[model samples]
Target: MTEPLQHADHLLRAEGLECERDGRTLFSDLSFSIVPGTLTRVEGPNGSGKTTLLRILAGLNDNWSGQVYWCGQPRQKHWDLVRRNVLYLGHRPGIKMLLTPLENLQALVAGRQQVPGRVLGQALEQVGIGPWSHVPCGQLSAGQKRRVALARLLFADEPVWLLDEAFTALDVDAVAAVERLLEDRVRQGGAVVMTTHHEPAMQGMRRIRLGGAGEQGPVTRAVGEVD
Candidate 1:
């Protein structure tokens, strides 16, 4: 196997991040570092820059000004290296309606890594969509489609995950399952930075609140707060 670009000690770091949209400043001078084996949740009221922040971290939206580092190196210097290790799951399930769950999974991991068909089937089963693995995603309900998207987590080997409202269409049981999965990832030395309104039940999950009264700047919880 090829060696990883990131190490355990070298985590994600952002310095002096600033963003504005529609003439409104979303955030400025924001900074934070996410260490492996921990979860960082970005919180805020409506219209706050939670989504924008996640996108910036994922290198999806580059309108913001900041320096994002992966393993103490600039992202631009190692874009491919960083992108290979980071998985960005957006607010919507980026699934192709005409394709089956199996097909989607195959396409997603294509060129990155090779997986046997049985593994894909097992991953679908893990997410409770085993029987629908061969069915076109268009027939699945919203919750089911979300589950299909989440199935990526099962076979995903990325060290860092950026989830934006990932739990939106899930039911209570599914939500709990995802929470446990996230916690397990951290326990296994993976890092996650997500934006969600739902309070995470995972222990030691840090928080960043944006856009509140007297809180123009991002309010990051102290490291001591993780426990």
Candidate 2:
């Protein structure tokens, strides 16, 4: 397991985040802190800008105004650090259709580190794609393609993860597998901020409900650390 970040505070924090689109306000004064060893669920009805909020936190969107801190430093000043360490998984499977799952994973960790083929294959097997690891991703079903993307979670050494609707195309068993992955990440002292409609069986995940009255995301815990 990867070691926890060395920070003495929240892994990531946002203050007074506000974003507007199409001449309408999506959310205002939103704030949250992602504590280590915890999962934060960004919840709201469709079109409430949960994805947008995540993008802002991940530094993928620049159209918003907010005070975002990474390891207690302003994110804008340390953008490279944030981008390098945080793994942002979008709603769609972000993989090349023409490449095999192994190839896609190779490209993902290309510049950072060299991984052995055996390790890559083990990651695919963990995600239930071992039987089709070498098949071109274009020929895989939707869930399989998502599994290809999900495999990166196994290779993640980052302290922070931003997942936008990662559960969208997964089946029951696959979703359960992801939940276990989340559990593992937290156990490794990582922080997770995700947007998903699926009610995870793992409990005590803090909720950030957008577009509601006074719903600015806060760092309040409903229970103790995840079991």
Candidate 3:
């Protein structure tokens, strides 16, 4: 709405990002750019803080110290603009279990956009859970609950997506569906930064590997084989 905060090339960029949790140093001097039309995988062992890093990128965590630039400027100076253009999906489904699947989705897009009920239903259908849309999420299976969360991807208008293990618990079909969705978004000039154990079916994915020994810090690589 406000002409997208005037970016030269990158949609999001982090410079010298450093953070620690429980006194464990997660990363240091971590710099990267999330440009349009690319898929970035945050690769790391368990407890390596992939989720923590995603939170920082999405503005959900402020415990970290570093400069995150939204559209090539400091995040603090234009955080509101940053918030508007990014869609974040945490590892948890984040659905209100007491609410129906439809209701959960309604709440997701409520303040962000004026999505109609029919459109919302279509999103559920696209994710292969339309029949269960009216049923409470508490009654849904693990995979179904994940699908409900995945449904939001269908209608989310945000250009930047920060997904944490988004493919977990999904069936083969559902995983493929989400893969297609990611491909579509990237083709349309959107950027996605995600963490997943499942190897993505999509090609040309860059990776940021965390943990292990390095004189400088954890390694974040781009478009190449392991070094």
lDDT of each: 0.83, 0.80, 0.84
Pairs in steric clash, model 1: none
Error of 3 at 195 (Å): 0.1
TM-score of 3: 0.92
Instruction: List the lowest-lDDT window of 10 residues for candidate 1.
Output: 216-225
Q: What tens-digit string does per-residue lDDT give for candidate 2 at 89-125?
A: 9986459999999999888777655778888899999
Q: Judged by lDDT, which candidate is best?
A: 3
Candidate 3 lDDT, tens digit per residue, 56-147?
Answer: 99998989988989876888898778888899999785799899999999898888879999999998888888889888999999999999
Clashing pairs in 3: none
lDDT of 1 by residue, 1-227 (tens): 55543434657788889888877778887878878888988888877888888889888897989898987898899988888888999987569999999998888778666789889889999999998988999999999999988988987888899999999889999999999999888888899988888887889878776765245454433232574
**Model 3 misplacement above 4 A:** 2-8, 213-227
